[model samples]
Target: MDDWVDPGETLETASFERLYRGALELASSVERTRAATLVLLTGRLGLTLEEALHCNEGWVDWERAELQVPEKDPCACAGCWELARRRREHTDPIREVLYEECWSPSPDRAPRTVPFGWSRRISAALLATADRYLLDLLPGDARELLRAAGEAADGIEPDDLTPGLLAATTVDFLSDLGLEADGTAAVLGVGEARVEPYAAAGESDVTTRMARLAGVDGSADPESAFPVACGTEAFESEPFDVGAADADALAERATATDAPERVPRPTDLPASVDYDPADHAAAGGPNRRTDAGSWAEGPSAADGNENALRADGASAVTGADRGRAGLPDDPSTASGSQATAPDVTCARDVVTQPVVADFSTRAAADGLCGGREIPGRVILGQEELFVLWSEEKGAEDADAPHLLVPLEDVWDVRIDDVPGRLSASFPHAVTVGHRPSGRDELAVSIQLPPAQRRDMASALYRILLNVTPMTVVDPAREGGRVTDADPEEMVLYVRPHGVAFTDEAGDAARLAFDLSDVVDVERIERSFDGESRPAVQLRRVTDNRPVTTVVTAADDRLRRLVWRYVRREYHQTLATVRGIRLSDAEKMVMVALYSTDGTPDLGSLLDLTEQELSAALQSLAAKELVRSAEAATDLTGTGQLAVSDRLESVNH
Candidate 1:
């Protein structure tokens, strides 16, 4: 069954069926090409609204029955360039650096070929949709179509309709007509085929399949396969048999019976626990407690308790508290407090020791020197590596002139022997290769002190390995023929946008997979030369082929680390594709809740007004990403995933 539904409202099965039928009828009234385009792209092919817009007729291979989606090149148009230029004008160097380097405008669209075969009706509709030129339907047109469909189904608001919602409904409608395995398998080509009782049919056998789907078998009633109108005599008279019945038949039976006991409505259910707003306010909002003695002590005593509560609930222990308790807050500090509050460690607390170095920059385009070396203190931060050149050492000022390099952009970092003209104290040179604007690589070089040289080098190596290129051999192709052995030795590079395998010199890419395309990543033990060794396995789909590759590193630790990085990258990338962008206030509230135990006084902590906090919470709750009950607000599973994605970007 299709899991996706319209976010604005949850429709009952009967209402959804009515809506589906109405939509199909409404679609039939539109221009044949437009109607076909709407139904085929979203319903059969399962392309998202954005993907459907970018699609061209030429992408479809008639002979292979496949649609080949090409990678999108970064836009060089005047409008796009203007936007990019304006984005780079931020006053904060760190923000500017992140926007330029770490952040990507869109998720990676690696070239993908999806094999698809549909019933004759769908095939004819698609052919008509793509007459001579590529289907050039606009977003407004798609919206209008969905709006009309909504209106036809008992006046659902046009504003509540979204492309994703409509597409999901269409898929569900088709699935009811017995195309579940075929349609779902074709859409999800990365996995094994789903088993069904009916033999999978080809285009020629589509007519028979359609007939079977419609319940046209000798003894079955044709109308039995579809949903019946609610409260109708025909619906009540018809006997429902659960055996061998599809979803529509079940829905029809359920709707006809008006079984409130079977399908309880949210509005009809009574509250599990009575909550009094008056009592809540008298207690001084959600975060404040009202124990018998505390409440009797009045507002003054309540204030002190609130402060104490804040101290206990706050994830990070302050310097004042550390001194008063005579216990260090650092987890590494040999103390029992670490065990008691294991989650106290925040991302900001994990800062690397600063190393004195000389920094220089070179233009990526021309490979020419952009600046001369300047003495500075280099610090490896949670988010980025920065160099502060101010004479006042040990001072960390945001406004000071500094060079910031986002960690996500640092693809490669290697230590080299320092040459002449540099300080003798800084004897080692560390070179970083990164793409600031998703263009050519910019090289940032720093000469590190001899004492902390290895420490800094190892730190960079460990943290940046996700983006660094590593030599890997494809075990499957190791003993294959010479012609098929080209991929035996390749360099694998995992970036925020995508994963790619290139030649030894990293000049030409042999294979590349979008983070979205990677369906699975696993760590497994592989036997080589009668010895067991750890390896990472990646599985992706390409041109109807489920490609699996096992990658091994020089040691078990490195391989395990690679697996972790790959999995993390995959999750983060998937989260971005959800099309959910939280506002600044929403983010602050989410992070505060994620980092702290119980609910903090969000209004005070985030400096948000009561109205603003309420609005943000409502929006989050509507999206099903957050859950709140009375005084406590917590993240739903989806909310946790979203927050984790955001935290990874900051903590990396």
Candidate 2:
């Protein structure tokens, strides 16, 4: 049983209540040194101060920045809300946590090394202050000393670790990286330091703060968060440079320095940003919105406004849902009424079941690897997707599978097929992932039966294909950056049509080629540490050129998936052409046309052919690979349109 006390349970006890009351007093010390006492006790008690203080407050949890307090639930007991440090991960097989599935399967094992990486824990301490009760405790029941102290447990909060040193370190770190220290300081808006750390701190914490300082933060929330803080000491020390604070001066300086406008003026909106029904129809698809509203808002408009100042609310709004798209999540809406007991009818009857698809049934995923929860199958719970294991060998053991990918967290997928598995899959696995801002994309593979692999590939492709476009720009710029730079010189971003790269700052240049144009992709290998680290290389339609671009973190799966998608039409065309029985001469003509720009030497094809030249011309044209320009045909737009659309039309 867990030793941590639940305030709701123990608060009624008079002795325990008195001890908790004392902890509260010591924890929030006006005399900073007393706060140190609370910190010390947290270590001794083996709980983070936040976890400790939360152990009290009716076991209230002031979760992260918005301070969400989840209502108590059946599983919100001391075991899951552990008071002890994590020597081993909690699991469903043992610890009854918040939800059966929320239980992590990984175990705490010492790192594999010649000498064990960790072991041997022992502790001793010298105390300066003691009470009569403390004197008795030294030689008294060992349980009392190790047993969680009620007074200490009821009131510990995480140390917002004085932000002074952290803040200075951040500024100095940026300066050392060749950034102008004063310019960076001015951008942060303090007199070199102090007075409210990263204003973004209210909405974010340490991880978010570091991302912003390094100019790499993305709009997506961090996987976890911890608080950051600072006090008023630097503000009290000195005051300087009051004039740079003037809004008009800042604006004037921005204009004089040729900085880009933070938002497009309504008058400056690109024509492409406006909706057009005709173009959508021509693409063989209907517009997603028929309300005559714009369908082409700038790519980042949907997700990039979280850090925007409240004063800039007008600019932050998107064309959809009247700017509601950019709003931060509201914590107040999360009070989902206390988790409650269910009536008998609330549970699904297990006696009878309806038919399920063969592919979706557990039997389909069940393979030589035992059970429904296999290494390749997705584990669903908490409305998310995760693969149970990364590798299958000995995966029956919970601790062996070190990787678990929450499926919905995946943003992009690229499959690379390996020889051996049917039609082309190595062990029939594909990797799916998301690219974070300018960072490399992360991919994890899930093995599948060949029958299921095709279905999974299509579903994953459609999922990533539909995500609204994203553009990555330098995060440190006061105003955002949008560019028209060439793909070779820009940071890569995904769009519905293809990936884009911007070579210049602001609205200078953007190079986005259609996905259809990508001809091939290859993996670039690196082995600096005797382990393979590879990047992706993409080639456009012209195969002779060196690979067009290399995307970091793009694994074998991405390389394969891109080529698979890009060559579907090419393969289809070849399949259709191969159906016809074309002689060597006719086949040679088409091959030459495909290879050299659009013109082919049918003269060589017709000059030494066993068949008549007229017959050869008719034969090639029948396959739609080539057509006769001199044939008797209507002088209508059809001829001109055909020439523009087809590869080439040669004269007889």
Candidate 3:
């Protein structure tokens, strides 16, 4: 029964609370390397992989072009620059430098370059490192928890912040890691200012207050306009005193419910017993008698004996009132005041009931709801509900409407627990719908900002998986081994996976290896199966033509055929446009345009760079058709060609 209860319930209801916290810290070292690589590729080489991969070596003929590629140079191609190997060299040490520099007060004294370019790369790397660190700090059952969180945070804007999310993530991380409660709480409180702004904006005062109760430091600088629609803390803190007292007084004030009168009136006080004024004078001195006579002179005072009783009772009542005035107001006092005045906003549930309750009850009655009887409401046509909820759930961990409800009420919930769903941020995608199909039910979805999602997932998944790329050389592979060896005759080359490298020497006919032949297995404490990309190979058959036969190593043709099918499905296009490794495509397009001209060809088109034209001409000459000559033409030849074209058009 205890295990069956929701963890949140246990956390809130139990006398003691325990949260799992992560020991790992978040950083962006891994991301920095990728960014750096992209920068170098685009900035230095002027190439975009999106377009350059379209031209293969054969497609880039260089006979008439000036770009040179020595046949014997193995390291002289654009695709074989060894970016991952280079990245490893650039990152590991630099990350340590950055970490130390950040910790140091004197940043200027830091031992490395901190340029804008460096910062971008570093930020990217830090983001990646932080994700892995977070995963290590989460629990094994973190998936369910994170999914619930994401669902809770659905529809939230990336910029919206809330303290509920911060506390939730903190508590969840601590609980997942099985950390010491005190230590977890302390850590949760640490950096509250930094985390709170990213998590607490746009939330209700109650929810924000609750977050503060949990030690969240920051407050919404500018409070939200629709605070009621905010998260639980505010909803939970809905005052039940004088404002809500109206509901109880509903029967007393109006002939509403059948309940008995609950509101107390001042007139309901007991009447004082009649007494003689002579008794006050006889018991006390002249001072007491004089005070009694003064009171007796008032209009409310009755005849002699009654006036004496009223004066004595008034003195007694005033003394009691003085004692009460000294005592602080408690719940009872608060209730007493409401009982007399019955202020609707004072905690009276007078006219309006909790909107959530109405929604829940209506939904349950219509089979549209299931959850604890929380007294709150979701206004119809309120678009900000999701944003408010996400702010509560923390940007990353928040899910959609379903997570806020009891898990039992929901038939099915879908979540993506994996990292990188939103680019290294574990922004889990969540959706809830009735049955397998239901038109009557409401379905909502959201893409959590990449950073927030990653943070949440890391907080949930306690297991950290490291991704380190390595370059390996295999002797038996066709594209030649990645070894410290001399250049040899090879038809194709293979580039390292997930890294961008440009050939240094710029050689055509350079041997490039396939994505296969080299394994990029993740070393996850040797506990998990490593993931790999689809493999491919390039080969030239006996027919004197290049045919890329994606064959199996075991000589199993049928299995190879099946693999081809799978690969085709995975890769989709076999036109070889996706895998080419080059710097610029405009050069190729320019050369192709020039190829249409005859005779000196007026040189190549103006748009092409020397590199693309050179590479292409080399490939064309290899095919033995296109030729080039240095036929320097004067201005007269250019003019004559322009005039000749115009005359030809007129004659037509």
Candidate 4:
């Protein structure tokens, strides 16, 4: 509590996002902030949470051997001096801002500060790397998409721009890809000279592309090398929309699959044979023959009618009709003459293989879940869909999932609208939840631009259908992250019912939670295969002094099994004690106390009214998750009974 004041008190805490913006505003100078931020963000000189909160130009001298904090008072009791906490605050919001955007985690123990927002001063190289990461996350042939965009954009480097700019530029490039030199110039608002360079540079092959990625110079000849591995024709990244032609294509594919019948292609000739060239010539001379004989005997009345019919037929053969026939509207005007099919990949599979196949009817695992996927991965292997999502911290990392969930276990996927918006620009969110374990439920939110929601959802649906569990659960295996082991030894593997481990005797042991004594699950970092797999550490209610045993992350799944078991047990214990879901007010109060080092006076800190506080306390008391009245009743001055015996595990 030494010289700390909560910034939330003076500055409004209505929207937590503001806290991040405010930090950058108070960062003193933009350039200093950008540079120090990059260092802190990149985890080069790893600073702890305490250090990051108090960091300033004076605080962190990365070049110095010893990390130093000058003797001067860092907080002015309301002064501008950088301080850990002008008031007690939780670091989650701040951490969320930095890591999700620019900060890359380091394998080492030293903590680092991460900011959520950005300014243009951020180096171009860093922006490129970040954009690459985003593109990597998108499902599909990312390389092909990149190459196609580069070709369309002429010579602009794909990685030269930030993610936002890259996305916009890609849309333009793909749309203008087949345009003629003149059309491309018109679309790009540039001269034909610029279009030539883009077109000339467009044909780089895959080998040269890889060379470029490796920092090699000179473009690869398109004929010499192949385009990106996705087979260069390219898949447009835009979400799908259905059209009549697409519907017919789907039907054709279906018919072929069912009966392998050959389908006929439409004729190159006009559909209507009503046109008479002689009549057309007499009417408008459009049907005039090249022969000298035709000139000698001018078109007769019948010839005039034929000429008019030809004109009418030509009109019907262009525009919409041409599109339906998959032909150019005007053969001479169509650019490049290298046009491939309109990128129909998204729309092709969308309608037939929708997330929920036959939504008007029921199908097994047929429902679609569309939302912003959480950070965790869905490893879809041969036989299973192992779903994992988490913030990968203490308890969260432990309960993460790894093994297969039976196909039938996945059910109850429901989509609900989340009303309201933080700003005019931000779209209203929609939440999607699915029960992958039959018993356990997980949910995610989609907050994309309104126009892009359906497309994103379609992409997500395809991914969900394809995902598999990281590894099949096998008891004989050395690594099985979730262990429901026997009671005596250390838990090294997570079982369906308990955890397994090696004891002090160097013998295998197992332990199942009574669902009472376990306090919290903390992920302890350990190295494996030159990579670090976070191991789980348990905190118990029995003895605070003794250190607990670690449950290792075994197998291919990243700490999912251990994380899931620990968290599920923790929640089950609370549910047993509380008997129902905690209200928003109750959860907030618990979080507030937890954030403030488990102290009383939570209502004032959270800016909750007395009535709200009373109701929340009542719920906490009924659930037996907290002693609301105990702190108020305390005769000697001390913090309130902030959390219950079971709930205390969550706080840790």
297-362 per-residue lDDT for model 3 (tens digits): 111111221111111111111111223223222232111111222222222121121111111100
lDDT: which is higher, 2 or 4? 4
Candidate 1 vs candidate 3, TM-score winner: 1
Q: Tell me the tens digit of each residue's lDDT in model 2 across 423-512.
A: 111122444554334445554444433323434454444322222222222211121233232223232333333444433221223444
Top TM-score: which candidate number? 2
Tens digits of lDDT, candidate 1, 219-310: 33434344331111122112222221322232233233231111011111124323221221111111111111111112121122111111
Ordered by TM-score, highest first, the candidates read 2, 1, 4, 3
TM-score per candidate: 0.24, 0.26, 0.15, 0.20
Clashes of 3: 95
Off by over 4 Å in 3: 1-546, 553-652
**Top lDDT hit:** 1
Give the per-residue lDDT digits (tens) of candidate 4, residues 1-652: 1111122211111111122222223222432233223222222122322232333322221111012232221121111111212332465332222212211112222221211111111122122222122111111232233333333443344343222232223223322223344433332223455435333233212111222322222233421222211111211321111111121232232233332111111112233322221221111111111110110022221122111111111221222223422334545322111112212122112121111210110001112223222333222221223333333211234334322333233332212132111111111222333455344554433332222233223222222321111211122112224443322222232222233332322122323333244545566674434566566566443121112445453342334434544555554454354434556676677666544434567666766899998888776666555543445411100012224433454343
TM-score of 2: 0.26
Clashes in each model (backbone N, CA, C under 3 Å)? 0, 13, 95, 59
Instruction: Count steric clashes of candidate 1.
Output: 0
Off by over 4 Å in 1: 1-3, 6-32, 71-117, 132-134, 153-157, 170-652
How does candidate 4 fare on TM-score?
0.20
